[model samples]
Target: MNRLKLTLIRGLPGSGKSTLAKTLNAVHLEADMYFINKQGEYQFDPKELKKAHLWCQNQCKYYLSEGQNVVIANTFVKHWEMQAYRKLAKLFNAQFSIKVCTGNFQNSHNVDLLLINKMKKNWQP
Candidate 1:
């Protein structure tokens, strides 16, 4: 049987987490997908952050249960933000790894550089 793996990609808004997730041949799950409307546009709603994260975790669990590798890209700056996923990986006996992207590419989200720098400073890896 193939080993199941779960990769968590963390970084600032413009740090290239999404880019790395796209390169990996696994289920690419991101909380931002929850904000996408039927019009095929991204509309972020701060109030729905919890719901989005739950959706992401559910998707990861579904994929892992099927013995597939999963890759999640999000600005998980703190360790607490990643604990649930780590526990899920343990539950499924999947290999878990965390990748931190530190690239300085232009942010697709258009977040300000000052905010990005602040995030980097507070980033807990």
Candidate 2:
């Protein structure tokens, strides 16, 4: 397979992006993981988000070059965020697909608020 295959999976904080990524055996890159590693310890500097993005971009390029699939797990709330990755995939001559996870607004809203409160309680900052 010479062409790259990219899968962009988007969902709110508590949805199953990571789970699906793992199940598919795809290269998983999560924004929250950019902040915290497998142990859930915050290891990245606050100023390093941009660097993280580039690193993830490079990783995607590398895996694609190896003809492997990728699953990018992120909130992807804005069109621009997803656009950047789409551009990257295009630059690499890769195929791309976007999967947006959605649910009832009231349920999603409640889940969002509940997650926010939980994060507040546990957030190191």
Candidate 3:
């Protein structure tokens, strides 16, 4: 049996959450990836982000059940969001850790800005 670990990578618009997610070799489930409209504006429809979040949570559960690790690369800007992930981690009997990266820290290649601009340009809802 493999032990599942739920790693939460939280940050603002220009944080390096995606980089960290990739570094961990885990799944990268971010809401912005799902909300690319035709105009390339990365705006989620009303309540669509929540639905995407739920989908990620379900995926996480399935992976954990199969002894895989998951890294949630998203801006969990609210306490409720954190709580929800924690609850899911508990339900899966997996170890959970929260990793917060404030965009203020110095990093390589300014991934946050890149992601922001990419979303602005290519986001197709």
Candidate 4:
């Protein structure tokens, strides 16, 4: 049997979380994906933020249950934000790991600098 691997990538916008996810050789998931439309356009709704995260988590759990490797990239500004995934890994008996990105690349979502600053200020690590 293949080992079940769960990787959580945390970083600020433009910090290369998504870029890193692509190379991890796992089923890549991200909370922001919930905001993207079928047409591949990103239309984020702040009101749906919680729901988006839940969706991401569910997807991760589904894939992990099937014995697939999964990697998720999200802002994860606070340390507690990653607890749910950690729990899921434990429940599924998957090897879990966390990677933090500190790059300053261009933020594809066009997030406001002020908001990014706010997230940086609240970063647990």
Candidate 5:
């Protein structure tokens, strides 16, 4: 039987979380993907942030249950933000890992510098 793996990639915006996830050969997922429109345009709605995260978590769970390696890249500024993914990994008996990306690159989502700074200020790491 193939072993399942769940990888959580955490970092600030532009920190290379997504870049690293792509190289891991897993089903790469991110909450921001929930904001993408059918046309492939990102239409982020601040009011739906919670829903977006839930969707991402649900997607991860689905893929893990199907015995696939899943990688989630998100700005998990606080440690608690990773709890749900950790629980999912436990439920699936998957080997889980948390990777923090510290590279400074251009943010694809265009998150404001001020907000990114605030997130950094409150980061648990």
Candidate 6:
């Protein structure tokens, strides 16, 4: 029997969440991917955050239904922010784990370290 796995990579911007997600051989999903425009550019919109997350969740469900391992990378700073994915894991009967990234790399988003630190301080498991 093939067992499914769901990995959530949580961290603030500039952390290594995305990098770690890429390292895993799973279906990678992230809310930030919604920001990629047809022009192949990242255009973030605060108003679309909910939609982005919803899309990510939908993709996770689709992949898990197909018995594929999934990895989600996002700034899930609060416990509630992770609940949806946790529920999905349970629904799909996938082995679930959360990886918190603490490394402060030069973020591709160019977010300031101060803001990243603030997010880290406020982060909840």
- All candidates: TM-score: 0.93, 0.68, 0.69, 0.98, 0.98, 0.93
Question: How high a TM-score does candidate 5 get?
Answer: 0.98
- Model 5 C-alpha lDDT per residue in residues 1-125, reported as the tens digit of each score: 87899999999999999899999989999999999999999999999999999999999999998889999999999989999999999999999999999999999999999999999999998
Q: How much lDDT does candidate 3 score?
A: 0.71
Cα-based lDDT at residue 103, candidate 5: 92
lDDT for every model? Answer: 0.92, 0.68, 0.71, 0.96, 0.95, 0.92
Q: Pick the candidate with the highest lDDT.
A: 4
RMSD of candidate 4 to the truth, in angstroms, is 0.7
lDDT of 1 by residue, 1-125 (tens): 87799999999998899999999989999999998899989988889999999999999999999888999999998899999999999999889999999888888867778877787899894
Tens digits of per-residue lDDT for model 2 on 56-98?
7777778877778788876665566777788868876778998
Candidate 6 — number of clashing residue pairs? 0
List ranges where model 6 is wrong by over 4 Å. Answer: 112-114
- For each predicted model, how many residue pairs clash, with residues at least 3 apart or on different chains? 0, 0, 5, 0, 0, 0
Ranking by TM-score: 5, 4, 1, 6, 3, 2
- Report the Cα lDDT for residue 34, model 1: 94
The TM-score obtained by model 3 is: 0.69
Model 2's alpha-carbon lDDT is 0.68
Per-residue alpha-carbon lDDT of candidate 4 for residues 41-115, written as tens digits (9 for 90 to 100)? 999999999999999999999999888999999999998999999999999999999999999999989999999
Superposition error at 65 for model 5 (Å)? 1.0
Tens-digit lDDT track for model 6 on 1-125? 97899999998897899999999999999998999999989988889999999999999999999989999999999999999999999998899999999887888877667877798799885
**Which rank order by lDDT, best down to worst?**
4, 5, 1, 6, 3, 2
Off by over 4 Å in 5: none
Please list the residue runs of candidate 4 whose C-alpha ends up more than 4 Å from where it truly belongs after superposition: none
Output the lDDT of residue 21, model 1.
98
